[model samples]
Target: MIAIIADDLTGANDTGVQYKKNGYSTTVKIMNDNDVSSSMFKTSDVVVINTDTRPLSKKDAYDCVFKLAEKLNSVNNLEYIYKKVDSLMRGNPAPELEAILDSTDAEIAIVASAFPDNGRIVTDGTLLMPDNKHVDITNIFNTETKRKAVNVRLINVREGAESLKQYMEGQMENGADIFVFDTVSNEDLATISDAAMLIGKKKIFCGSAGLAKQLGRKKKAEQKYDGTVFIVVGSRNAATAHQVRMATETFKLPVVLVNSEEIIDGRYEKAVSESVEKAKEYYLNGNKVVIIAIDSLFEEYTVVLRATATENAKSLKVAESLGDIVKRLYEHIKPVTFVATGGDTAFQICNFLGSDGMELVDEIVPGVPIGILREGMADGSSMVTKSGGFGDEDTLVKVINYLMVNRK
Candidate 1:
């Protein structure tokens, strides 16, 4: 009788699948904002949390875990402990849980994966960050001095474009040579040719979503950007990130992994702002800026703003804040193309642009809607009346992948 808590549907499914495969009697629940009763706690022996059963904020997730623990501990003082699984592992642990576990005396185990030898967590844990240090993209870039030539493929849209802009700036500051391909059409060969002309080196190529799949089909060492370092940003562990990694490896491209979970850590708002500012600075310093956002999800904070707003006044206030940020950002660096990701972001952007509503043309990314804004909407009219299909971790992955690979 093992309890498995998931933060989302995908995590719940994945964890349930793994436990079933391992011959464990597991019950995976997609957690909502609620308390777990003591009776629910008495049913399981080994609980696996896939970071899905809770919200995005670490504080919220930690609070939920604490509540769960309190409810469970009352029934049976089960030896409470925290466990971390790797990106390659079947169970994906939430970062917030890792933080909560760090604060407790409960036994922590890093089962199967290599644990950080000198990390804050002791050796008793199975998996650890390399060298016991939190992995940072900034540190990775600074460690290498020789300029590496890389090609970046941006899908192009609005949502998390600022993060990519910031990452590109960071790479340029670290003296890495970068080439960007603004392709929303999934034309990999064309993008490769464009990248060849821009940078003239074929060492690395970074892309996301459909772009990664396009690259995956090519013969290894056959394209203009052969033996490239491939990076994919702004997707989930199962979806874009995993696919891109496989494609890069299959095509014999050198790969450096950067997930969104790794980018902001606990300070999401600050990270987003910092990334946007960095991109602006890079553009001002005379570097070419190529931002690729597949859709409106690139500007997720805007979506969050819309989601947080229940009333028209609240929505207007949030939209006004977003408008200010966008205006300031555009003043510094105007992206060549603003690609919108999901329908919600597109609607919000269109609303911001004084459109009525967007038309649903296609679902660009699976489980995400892509649409065009309707004509003749009044200015300041709220388009995103209610928010749906927003996955914080998935969105974070998408943002980070774009930044890490596209960084100059």
Candidate 2:
């Protein structure tokens, strides 16, 4: 039985769902005494525990994971453990990694966070994404303002597993706790996975959802949605705004604008009632892709003016309203493909639609992923997600084209 440990609810859901998609009955446990249902253990082949310790201090976080690791270690059927970290390298990975290392016989922890499909790659010990940039390791974890800088070493995968082992041993001698493995593609990830599994001593795996997907690849359902696709655009970024415009003008995709400002005024419920019906009409009238955006012109400008910390809460309300619109339309139309852009908006929609987690099947674009949910919808209903600033002007139209030409 595989066990996945995550820092947040969404991370647990998304990573665990990947295993579920691959035919393992998976459960995302809330990790509370009264909440961990016994039936979940009986039904799931994999049990994912959400520690919910990302926001905690280093000591607290370490203690939380240590306790959980101890509990899992007691389980007779528990196999190797997977420590899930954020894809963007957010949150504290070292403390939790240390807990896993201390609890298990695992001599080394493999830290591979390269999700090439999501356009994030680690090459030569530096994160190579957003234009071949490496993380600023020197200042990242130095919370104490006056602490001396810690030097980190990057070992290339081309150096082979022996070289990696020697380098890790050297790092251990020098007191380095974590190491990042470089990967440029899916093949590279598979190679790394194989090498880690072949380690002489026991090992613990640490990475984002990408590495988990690679390690747990199996024959599962193929998710394809060539039918009506609904595109939900909630990003106020100019890049997304331009993409929305290009998609409608270049592809003639139907557009339905929701008054997001109304949400801030406590009128979101009133707005969704109309948007959902219009979306239904638009889809039924022979439009293959329907673009649901906020009043783009207003969003384009107000988003700039609302750039203060005080206004962020209000901005979230607008995001929530946009999510509600998408949820209503999705349930009403049951569109084959659900495309949601912007992180907050996408999370809200997934929450409403009960997309506890999804199995990643394809990349609509680099860093823009399309996948099938493990539950809460039709088997093949494809769900696509994108960051607010991920793509270019023609990205949206190109996604629709990909869906059209590559039907399963």
Give the top-scoring candidate (lDDT): 2
Which regions of candidate 1 fall more than 4 Å away from where they truly are? 32-35, 41-55, 75-95, 98-105, 111-408
Lowest lDDT 10-residue stretch of candidate 2 = 143-152
Alpha carbon lDDT at 6, candidate 2: 85
Which lDDT tens digits does candidate 1 get at residues 109-199? 1111211111112122122232333332222222321224333334321224454445444555665453333333334323432333243
Model 2 TM: 0.70
RMSD of 2: 5.4
lDDT of 1: 0.32
Q: Model 1: how far is 370 from its true place, Å?
A: 27
- Supply the global lDDT for candidate 2: 0.66
lDDT of each: 0.32, 0.66
